[model samples]
Target: MTHPICRACGTQYAEPRDDCPVCLDERQYVAPGGQRWTSLKELQAEGHSGRFEEQGPDVFGIGVTPEFSIGQRALLLRTPAGNVLWDCVPYLDDEMVRRVEELGGIDHIAISHPHFYSVMVEWAHAFDAPVHLHEADREWVGRPDPALQFWSGRTKPLTDELTLINPGVHFPGSTVLHSSAGDGALFTGDVVNVGPDPRWVSIMYSFPNHVPEQPQKVRAAADLLAGYRFERIYGAWWGRVVTSGGEEVLARSVERYLRFERGE
Candidate 1:
């Protein structure tokens, strides 16, 4: 009686379905062969394991060993209040649970958007932590649970130092975690992509489907983020971090995107 998980996006469902609504949407695409499904047990049996690596003084990146669905790394922000789990992965095992517990268990779990909402309910239940998700994207939730908490507004503060900022770029509820730790860092889960240049980040409506966001939407997202002071920006993947000057980089990137969109 294992819940079915989408192989492409890693979203768990209350029951088995022919296709994952998230993947079938315009933002994402089903595989060429069609929709596929897998279970956590099946993934674990195939040798998928989760591991955490220190990215900064109190920030760690948690990801699967063999790279599970979507292949996005979850960020662990450790603070005096407690640890916050940002985003999630598909596969979770005893080893990963024990390791996270050793690091002082997750106090809260927050997802940036529906695309990164992979097995979040399971994670919350494991740590007895509350899951925070934006109300705008509540329909995208696959597995409903009592631990899920839906929020609205442009920003929601988790702790005095950490806040969830919704820029509304990729999705209506696209969110990023802003932390005052380590000269200020933004944990953006593909809402603001850390471009290859490392000095800039780009916003997109869809990464997989090659959909671009409107110029005004991009500008608005940037303007919303301008209110915050962040020195570094961390994206969902490994090695996708802007080491410094995140604010300037984001502004420049927005301008660049707008310029290109206008054929300037």
Candidate 2:
């Protein structure tokens, strides 16, 4: 039996349902027509395929070619310890699996928040890797599996150079991965949105709904990340990378966001 996937978010459900709880939430929205579901087989038949592109040294971005739901690219971080897959996408194919296997495969799958929890269990099972998600947002998980592992607290170290930090701006468990490779890079999955401008990043509660995050929450998130040292910021999607001065961009963006919230 083919598992049903949410048309909006592309999260596979444990069983078929009339409505997707994730889309019905205020943070997300159901289509005007209604809730629609599609299976991965259907998506593949429709010509959706996953591909990987090298973004930096040992860092590759994997995403669907035709662009499936939410259209976020997953980052494959190759480290000396092992490979870490950050923020999964909707579609995974044989080619993707083969390519990943060629690149040493994934040891751990970490999601930044509930929104990016797309087909995580499928990916984990495929690679026999551990799936890590924030414990606070466990309710949003559509498909639970034995590979799923819940974590709490502000910071969790996945490896010597890579650490997951919860900034708590978009969601209670919204996270960013700090890597000590190269100069340093932060793999932020919409937690810190690299924007229309490369010099700034924004925090939002809901990007589709145009809901801005609270000023205090944004400040607190930034404060929490201030301890980290990273020169680049990689957002969830393609072309959303802040190439340099990521630390400065975040500081200025937070200040600007707060000022606007205060009507200054």
Candidate 3:
């Protein structure tokens, strides 16, 4: 009967498929059905019975590495221009790299596409840091070793308080990285996803079903995330979003996805 992964993101695709074809098809689903798997050491033994949550002040949410999907957690900020790892989790051992080198080893490791770019060269050589990725998804780097570092076009600072904004909109170099901390955050990994009315956020075109047949490039990726003022907004799992505001919830989710894709 084995088939229960993806309670949010422990990808294990090989056979016996039903959904989660890279995050639920038909433009992402899971309204009340969407979850299935059978192997990968049972989602890494359920992320070794996962546990870890801080919430604020350098936010942290660990849990979901085991079979991944139970709110898939990974967020630890200390931006003063250093220590940032937006999205990355396919499970990394060694006590999660010694609790992230006692909190300071990771200098940088950005990711908002390529399926969360899991493992990411083993979390960038276990914190020697440097795994940017965005050269147009780099063909969905499913382990394109060599410590990876693609980047190209539209902003990229990395220190002096971090920066790396693409705003292309959901893949195709869909990027977003702007965190000076506190009331200034924007690490949108799915181009933007944080709803359930945490203030507002909902704009998609293909969130796993391929819906960008060209609605003006999904409103030009929500007009490149409406310029940015991010008071908080980080999404990739769970209730989606680790924080809030995030420039009025990404400008009311791009005017409610441009009035539901012009069906106005």
Candidate 4:
């Protein structure tokens, strides 16, 4: 709990440092007010509590009430195989642990990118679950731990019904999960961001800096996902979800993005 966590990115470092590399990266920004630091113990004392809401059938969106750090919500995907956590938040306590355990607990954890890797080791320890992260982004990991398991390649099947696919977009190892729930669903954590229009989605190299993703990379993501069957797309936020036509939405989104990028 005392480990120094970046206030801008919510990344908990193994040791204290004057700066957070994740924030300083072009993909993210150091807070305008300047870099600040906090710890889980401090957040608990500040009365930051967990917020849980059903984003889909059994997918619960979890985050801190005061929206700490990047303010992205992690998803508790209760798949038929087992309960897998899609991402992680910075704040966690006994209550959050107890609450999650009551919901069948977490069997595995998979993060989309480095920005959302906040206190993941904490969550993994709480539930005795292993974390699956892409190896390409290993250098960005704030705190290395045995609980973190790295995989390299385009896809790794977690269960009979779920698979992790790297789109190679926002981050070199940016991952998205496909679940055979209902018509199927893709759990993306800002890797393939669900846009304001639920029917559409977007990809970016640096969302904070408005940097466009490479046209080839975006096209490759869509091509890779074209093989899956999904109706819903679950984004990384509280309400950012595409309820239906997940496959078509992704295809169209990439086509439009490429066309626009080419000034067609």
Winning candidate number (lDDT): 4
Give RMSD (Å) of candidate 4 vs. truth: 0.9
lDDT of 1 by residue, 177-223 (tens): 99986689888989999877898788888898788998888889888
The per-model lDDT (C-alpha) reads 0.90, 0.90, 0.63, 0.92
Record all residue pairs in model 1 with backbone atoms less than 3 Å apart, i.e. clashing: none
After superposition, the stretches of candidate 1 with alpha carbons farther than 4 Å from their true spots are none
| Clashing residue pairs for model 4 | none
| Model 2 TM | 0.98
RMSD of each: 0.9, 0.9, 15.3, 0.9
Can you write out model 4's per-residue Cα lDDT over 133-225, one digit (the tens) per residue?
A: 999999999998999999999999999999999989999989999987579999999999997889899999999899999888888888899
Ranking by lDDT: 4, 1, 2, 3
Per-candidate clashes come to: 0, 0, 10, 0
Location of the lowest summed lDDT over 10 successive residues in candidate 1: 50-59
Where model 4 places Cα greater than 4 Å from the true spot, the runs are none
For residues 1-264, could you state the per-residue lDDT of candidate 3 as single tens digits?
332334454543323556665454344456455464435355455555444566566756554434444344667676565677777766666676777677766787887765666556656777878888889767545345667888798778877666887766666677778766557777675666675666776556565564653567656666665665667776756556646556766666577666777899
Output candidate 2 Cα RMSD.
0.9
Query: For model 4, what is the error of residue 218's alpha carbon versus the real structure, in angstroms, after optimal superposition?
Result: 0.7
- lDDT of candidate 2 at residue 150, scale 0 to 100: 92
Q: Which regions of candidate 2 are displaced past 4 Å?
A: none
